[model samples]
Target chain A: MPAASAIKVMVVDDQTSMRAMIRRALQDLGFKDIRDKPGAVEALPAVKTDRVHLIISDYNMPDMDGLQFLEAVRADPVIGKTVFIMLTGSADREVVQKAAALGVNNYVVKPFAPAALKEKIERVFGELT
Target chain B: MMRRIPIVQGEHAVVAEPGVIISTLLGSCVAVCLQDPVARVGGMNHFLLGEPTEGLGDRVGQERYGVHAMELLINRMMQQGAARNRLRAHLYGGANIIAGLGAIGSSNAAFARRFMETEGIAVGRCELGGTKARKVEFMPYEGRVRSSVVADAPPPVLNIKPLTPPDDGDVELF
Candidate 1:
């Protein structure tokens, strides 16, 4: 497992409360290098210019949605391989299939417990000690 | 002794009895409550966006959009013997909690207000455009709506100020 301290994670959500909640969850898991963006538009630029090991993004957003943003990230040469996880309120199969095809690491549905989020992250990075 | 029914995102509920309450939590999303004074019947809808076309999926998913949700609420209320002419609307929970992202809350509020106007319904109250999420409790049969800012910690403050009815000529920010 990569060290939680070394893994730079980014959380993208339009809702400030959701962002804070995710940030708190990451902090609880002992993740140190965490950054948050309000939407995929802002996140895209940051992912391009900086080094982000993992990204936790909300599926619904204005301007650019999570699927479009995931497609953009997968198309990029530098940031294409970054670990990606999607969070959404809807459990729509088509949306899940699209994210899977675009190479998302995992999916976390909304109203999820912090433990569930941690499990999805650990599934990507292995169990955190 | 009100029975509380939670209206999740993309859902709408109607109640005709006096002791039923509809509730929803909002962040950028908008909830519209409509009650017919004469019939004592009312309904509420929680919509994520202003229009159905903004969604990128099947028609079924479009139901969550404001256009469909709003129509559903109105249609359901009418089915419950609510008179369209006697319907009064209350709006809540359009907050720009995150800075830098587009003002989806503002857009949702504007869409709801315009929809009511175009439908010939009168708006009784509007609580919108702040940096905090809201927890809304609505008594549909009584036409009573209470809203509070959702806080991170304890003691959620109830916002129970006198509502100044907005002029039909202008859209006001709260």
Candidate 2:
């Protein structure tokens, strides 16, 4: 488990503006340490350093979408156990089913509230405590 | 009255409310809506990608993709007392979505246009193609959509695209 003082988070999404807004939202929620990426391909190595505690990724992306990102994380035992959440504008059944199948902690739709995202993170952390 | 019909990604529904609207948005994906004025019912769908995944939602043997998404929207309208002949269609989105993301959006738009032409559904309104990101608000009752640019995330001209797969392959994290 990562120390509370150093809560490293990595957010991945194809939409750059959305990613920035989400980063600001996390900061507004008092999450001091945050990192953002455009998609899975840009976030992979950044997560391997063993310092990241959570990953917030979008489901649909080029090269590899969200499911591929989850599968990629799963393939590597090192990053397999990290907390995962999916954020997207879509409320598709496939999105829900795939996240369920992959054991994601939460699934959030677009135009979502920062509080809801933070609540899910808190819930995940609370379970660890 | 507007009803909350859960139109799944590839499924669409027709409602009976005058004020309610049927809408869907796409970048690389596409949303197709069809309405029958005489029957006064219609439906819409949000399809991702041009090709159907392997064995995706097949009962016996049905490859549901762009074409399937459109068909489902039409079928749902028929279910809601819409006639087959009076159906009119409209399409929205299919923006480049994001660059370096492949040609999924362009292909999706192409497929949607072809599907409507072949189905004999008179295509009325269509706003598609571009480099901007968009959101589609669909109203089954109104048989129309309001497409808006919610957040424009223009690709970073220099070093914009990410450079990794998952938890490896460079691209500084911190």
DockQ of each: 0.01, 0.02
TM-score of chain B of each: 0.78, 0.71
lDDT of 1 by residue, A81-124 (tens): 99999875433456767888889888876545456677788888
Local distance difference test, each candidate: 0.75, 0.62
Best candidate per TM-score, number? 1
Worst 10 residues of 1 chain B by lDDT: B165-174
Please, what are the lDDT tens digits per residue for candidate 2 over residues B34-58?
Answer: 7777766766776664333332242
User: Which candidate ranks first by lDDT, i.e. highest?
Assistant: 1
Q: Write the per-residue lDDT of candidate 2 for residues A1-129, one digit (tens) a residue.
A: 334335778889754445665676676655667888776887887798644888999775656778888888877889888888876443345675777687777766543445556666776775211
Runs in model 1 deviating more than 4 A are: B1-174
